[model samples]
Target: MTILITGANRGIGQALAELYQDRGETVIGTHRAPDAGHLRELDVTDPSSHAALAERLGDTSLELLVCNAGVNLDQGQALDDGYPPAMWEDCFAANVTGVFLTIQSFLPHLRRSDAPKIAIIGSQLGSQTIASGGGYIYCASKAAVLNLGRNLAVDLAPEGFAVGVYHPGWVRTDMGGDRADISMQESAQGLAARFTALNPETTGCFETWDGQAHAY
Candidate 1:
């Protein structure tokens, strides 16, 4: 199977890429930085960058595409003036628009495969039932992307494609921080299983890393 993961230079994306590669699959790890060593260049926030990456891949068949690139600009912001206009723009651009653009640009490649799957790395914070408090921008962006994944699943189901939105556990990554709930290995393993289990019957599911269905 051929898998494409965005923001694979570090964090959960890197762990997922490494896991797939070790399983002898063709893993295409993409990073925004030019000096990302073995990873390919892909700025998820830029449509031109997605186009360039797609062109570079030519007719390569992609079995799985993981939209893991995102940003949390409003992390500890106050309810006052802490969340600026630019913060919202940048957060949504990377977390929501970037995911949509990546999927749109890679549809052809995905169509080349017999069984294509899309995994969106969303957050539990995005769940309306679990809306805690802080990180408003991140929550909103994730919620938007979750909706995107659900709609894409509906639209792509007839084409033999499945889309699953996942809340990778609070992992020990740069994004999740050191005091998180689970380790990167655990999250990656659980997510891999979730992705593998995704099928047309369960296309628009919002699930957790441990394979449990999350509240939409």
Candidate 2:
């Protein structure tokens, strides 16, 4: 399977790319940094970058498009910080708008394949049912992604596409911090396994990497 992953220079995205490559799948990893050793430079926030990447990819059909790029700027901020509107805008640009643009740009390539799956990397904090509080910007951005995934699933159903919005849990990555619950390898593997298990029938579901259903 040919898989296209964004934010592939580090964290879960990098791990996912490496794991898929190891499994003998064709992996096209994208990052914004031109110096990324194993990934091609791709700025999802820029339409020109997406157009260039599409041109580079040519006729390579994509079975899966993983929207794994994201950011969290409200990490250590207290509620007293007033949820920096700038940070919220940046987070939305990176986490929500980026996903939409990436999928839109890659839709033609995705349609070329017999099986097309779109996975948006979401977070548990995005779950409104479980949200008692808020990380403010980060939570709201991911929540937007979750909603996007749901609507996209419905919109793309007639075209024979499957969509999954998943939370990888608290993974030990730069963004997840050093005290996270699981290692990047473990989280990537679990997500990969879950992705492999999904079929067209389960298209619009949101779940954890470990197969637990996420509350909408």
Candidate 3:
């Protein structure tokens, strides 16, 4: 299967790419600025970059598209001086707009697959039911992308596409911090299973890394 993962330079995205490659799947891991590695350069916020990537792939059928690229700019911002206008714009650009543009640009490649799937890496904090009142920009962006995934699922179902939004848990990554609940390996394995289990029936689901249904 041809799987393309955005923001695969580090953290969960990198782990997912490595896992898929280990399974002998064709993995196209993309980063905003790649070094001397196998990862491709792709700035998800730029539509022109997406076009360039598509042109490079040349009709490659993508079985899975993982919109894992995101940012958490309002991590410890104070309510007084935190979450400024520019920060909001930057966070949304990477977290929401990037995901949407990627899906839009890759629709053709995804359509070529018999069972195309889209996995959006959302967060539990995005859920209205689980809101804890911090990281407003990041949470709102995630909520927007979650809604985007659900609507996309509805729109793409007839075309044999399954879209799922997921919360990868409090993993021990740069974003998740060292005090997080789980390791990258554990989260990656569970998420791989979730991606594998995604189908027509499970489309539009908001799920956790460990296979539990998440409240919207």
User: When superposed on Cα atoms, how far off is each prediction in RMSD?
Assistant: 0.9, 1.2, 0.9
lDDT over C-alpha atoms for residue 184 of model 3:
86
Q: Write down the lDDT of every candidate, Cα atoms only.
A: 0.92, 0.90, 0.93
TM-score of 1: 0.98
Candidate 2 wrongly placed segments (more than 4 Å)? 35-37
lDDT value for model 3 = 0.93
* lDDT score at residue 56, model 3, on the 0-100 scale: 86
* Local accuracy of candidate 1 as per-residue lDDT tens digits, 91-195: 999999999999999999999999999999999888889878888889999889999999999999999899999999999988889999999889999999999
lDDT of 3 at 3: 98
Clashing pairs in 2: none
Q: What's the residue-level lDDT of 99 in candidate 3?
A: 97
Candidates in order, TM-scores: namely: 0.98, 0.96, 0.98
RMSD of candidate 1 to the truth, in angstroms, is 0.9
**Model 1 CA deviation exceeding 4 Å by range:** 35-37
lDDT of 2: 0.90
